[model samples]
Target: MSLGSHSVMQGDNTLRAWRTGIDTYQEFVVYMRRDCPACRSEGFTTQARVLLSAAGQRSIVATLSVVEAEWLSSGDAGLSESAWAALGAQPGEPITVSHAPPLYSLSHVRAKVYGHKLGDTEFAEVISDVAAGRYSDLHLATFVTACAGDRLDLAETVSLTKAMIAAGDRIDWGRQPVVDKHCVGGLPGNRTTLLVVPIVAACGLTIPKTSSRAITSPAGTADTMEVLAPVDLDIASMRRAVERTGACIVWGGSVRLSPADDVLIRVERPLDLDSEGQLVASVLSKKAAAGSTHVLIDLPVGRTAKVRSEAAATSLGRRLQEVGAAIGLHVSLRLTDGEQPVGRGIGPALEARDVLAVLQGAANAPDDLRQRALCLAGDILEMGGVVPAGSGLTLANQVLADGRAWARFQDICAAQGGMREIPVAPHRQAVDAHASGRIVSVDNRVLARAAKLAGAPTAPAAGIDVHARLGEYVEKGQALFTLHSQAPGELAYAMSYVASRPPIFQISPTGESQ
Candidate 1:
C-alpha cells in the first residue's frame, strides 16, 4: 500500500533528511534552514506542527524549528534525535514535509480548561492524540493545567486512568495474583521497593516490579536499583528476570508501559503540580499496565511530606482505593511516618548503600528503612494471599533474617545483569549544628533540595548522608548531615543552599551536648 493512500500528502514538498544530533527527550523536533525552499513555500514557522514522512511508509508529526545556522543546505531538513529515530530515515533520504492535519482532540482539552467534565470517549481521544505525539508541549501543558487540583471529579479521574492505560502497552503475566508495590513519593531516602521486591520474591510470589526514575526527588527506586544493577530492562529482559528469580526490578519507561503518563509527568515535574486526580491516575495506570492484580500503596504522611495532614492522607487513600477498584486492581494502602527521611542516605548510590546494609542484616543498618520495607513487603504478601493477614510480617521478617532476601536480591541483580559496585563521590562536606540541643524536626523538602544541588540521580554518587534524627541530642559543631558530590562546585552549591535556609534539622535548646 502506498503511503499517500492513508496519510495526507500535501503536494510534493520534500527535503533531504539530515541528522541534527539534538536530544529533546521524547518530543520530536525537525530543523529547517531559515531560507529553505520548502519552509518559504509551506509558510512553516518555528514550533509549527509538520508531518515528516520517510520512504519506508513511516511517518511522524514533529514540531519544527527554523535553524539560522548555515550547517544545513537549502535542500536538507534536519532531524532531532527523537525525530530521526521515529522516521527511521537514512542520510540524504527524501522526507516529505507538510503541515500536519488539525487535531480534533484538542477541543476536548479546551473544554476541560473551561471547567467542563470529560467523559471516557473524550479522554480517550485526547490521550490517544497525546500518545501518538500529535500534541506539542504547549498542548500538553494546557491539558495538564486544566486538570490540575480538584478540577477532575472521581468519574473523570477514573476515565483518565482508563485512557492512560489504553494508550500504552499492558503486560499479562498469564497467572492470577501478580503482585507489585509503589510509594506516593515526597519523602526522601525511602527506597522500600528494593527491599520489598526481594522479600516477596523470596517468599515465592510473582513480582515483576517496574519503577520510575526520580520525577521530583533525589532518587527513585529505578535510580537506586541502577546503582546496584542494570535497571533499564526491556519487557523481554524483565520477563526473563522474573522467570528466573520470581521477581524483577526494572524501569517502567523502558518497557513502554503507560507511555502517556510519562509524557504528562514531563510537564508536571517542571510545574511541580501533582494534583490528586492526576497523581492517582499516574500511579495506578502504571500499576494496572504492569498486569498487577494486587498492589500495595505506601503513603508517608508528614507536615513536610507529599501528604501532609491526616485528612489529606485519608482522602487520597480513599481515592486510590476507589480508582483501583474501578480499574480491576485490588489496592492496599499503608500509611507510615513521614516525619523524617527513611534511612541514612538521600541519593542514588547513598540509598543503595543503605539498602545493601538492611538486606545483609548489618548491625549499623538504618532500622527505620528496614522496618518500613518489611511492613510494606508484608502487606504485599498478604494481599497476594502468600500469607494469612497478620502473619505476613513474621514471614517477611524470617526471610530477611535468614539471608534469603539478600540472596534473592543478588539472584535478581544477576538475572538483570551482573551486580554493580556502588559508586563513591570524591568530594564531601559536612553541615554542622551551631548550638547544642535535641533534634526536634527535619524538613524533607529542604533535604531533598540540598541533595539535588549536590548532583543526585544525575551524578549517581552525589547525595547527603544524614547524621541526626528527631529527638536525638547533638553537641555544637556536631555534624547534622554531610554532602557528597563528584564536583567541588556541586558540593559548594549544596552547602551554600543549606546555609542560606533555616536549619534543616531544628534543635530545641537543651543546655548541653549529649
Candidate 2:
C-alpha cells in the first residue's frame, strides 16, 4: 500500500488498534511488535517518539514501546489507556503511525538547561505544548531536571506559574476571599486539609479545596479523603458541592486546574525532587486556578522533612508569599513542627480513621492531629477574617467541640457523594520495640518509605499506624507501629525493610528525644 501523509509506508502497514488497559498516568504510549513491518519501514525503535492518528480526526504523540511477544500481531498496535482515551478509538479501529512533529519548545528547555532564564512567552509556549500532549516523558524529565535546585529565578518562577494557570481551566467562585489550605508535604499522616476544610466551612466560609493523590508519601489528602467520600468530582459537581455545603474536597486532577502540574508531578515524583521554584509554581497555580483568594500554606520543617532546615523553610515561605502575591493570591505561610508524623495513622483508611475520630470528637482521637488541625484552621479563619488573630483557635475549637464541624463535614461528604465507611487492611503486623526505653527521634522519611512499601495510597487501606510517640517509654515487646497491607507479600516486604534498616524509632536510655 502507498503511504499517506500521516501513514507509515510499508507492506500492509495499516495496523489495528488494541486497547492495552495500561495506566501510564499522563504520558501516552503505544506498543508494537519490534520487528513489525511498520517499525522497520518507519525507522521506529523502542522509546521512539511517534504520532498516532485514527479516523483522520484524532491524533496524539506517544512514546513507542516495542514488544517481542505474540500477543500483538505484526499488523496490530497496542495503546495505553491514556493513548486510547486521547485518540477516542474503538476496539478495532485502524491506526496510522508516523513520525512526530519537531518539538519547538524543546529549544526553550535547552536554553534553561544552559542556565538561561525563560521569558514569559517562552514559558507559555512550553506549558501549552506540554498540556497538549506534544511533549514525551523524556522531554518532561529534561525540563524538570533543568529547573531543579533553584535554577528558576523568582521572575521565571512567577512566569511559569502564570503559564501553568493559563494552560488549564480556572474556577471562578464569583465571591471574595475564597479560602483554601495546602501542605508543603513531607511529613506522613499530616492530613490536616481534611480537618481544616470542615472547620473553616463550618464557620461559613467558601473552601472549595482540591487535593492531589500521593506521589512519594504514604497518603495525600485526597487519598485519605477518598476513604470517606468520593474525591473525583468534576467541575460542575464540585461547584454544586460547594454551593450546597460551602466546601468540597475533590481530587484536583479531575477538574483540569493547572493540568500541567499534574503532568509534571508524574515525572517529579519518581525522581523524589521537589525543586523550590517548581513547588512554588505548582502550589500557587492550583490555588489561583481554583479561585482561591486567601490560602494558608503549611510548611513542615525538620531534619527529615521536605524543608530540612529553618533557613530553607524561610526561603520557601518567602517565595511562596511573593509568588502568590504576584498571581493575586493572598498567601499565608505557617511553618509547623515536622519532627514526626502528625497523626497516629499514616495511610489512607488509617488516616481517614484519624480524621473521623477528630471530627466526631471521639475520646481516643489523636491529640497531635487534632491540635495541629486546629492551629492551621485557626490561621485560615484569621486570614479569612472569620475571627480575630488570637481567637481563631478558640472559634475553631468551638466549631469542632459543638459538633458543627462534624455536621458540616457530613454535609460536605454527602454533597460530594454519600459518605462511606473507611476500610481496613486485611493483613496486619506490628513491629515491636527492641528494648524498653524512652522513644527518641523518628525518621519521617524511613517511616514513609515503610508505609509505601506496605502498599499505601494505592491500596487505600495499607499503611503504618504509629503507637509510640517521642519521649514515650515502651516495653521491649511493645508495638512501635503496626503495618497494614492488603497483601501478605506487601506486609512482608515492608517488614523486611524495617528489619534491615536502623531503628525507625530511636530509643534513649536517658533524656528527652529531640
Query: What's the lDDT for all of these models?
Result: 0.91, 0.91
Clash totals in order: 0, 0
- What are the C-alpha RMSDs, in order, of all predicted structures? 4.4, 3.2
Q: Give the TM-score of candidate 2.
A: 0.95
Residue 477, candidate 1: Cα error in Å is 0.4
User: lDDT per residue, candidate 2, 374-404, as tens digits?
Assistant: 9999999999998988999999999999999
For candidate 2, give the lDDT: 0.91
What is candidate 1's lDDT per residue for 1-514, written digit by digit as tens? 1111122223447787878889987789998877777788899899899999988789999999887865666677788898898889998788888999999999999999999899999999999999888989889999999999899999999999999999999999999889998889889999999999999999899999999999678998999999989988889999999889999999988998989998899888888876999999999999999999998899899989999978898999999999999999999998999989989999999999999999999999999999999999989889989889999999999999999999999999999999999999999999999778888888999999999999998999999999988898899999999999999999999989988999898888963323
TM-score versus the correct structure, for each prediction: 0.95, 0.95
User: What's the lDDT for candidate 1?
Assistant: 0.91
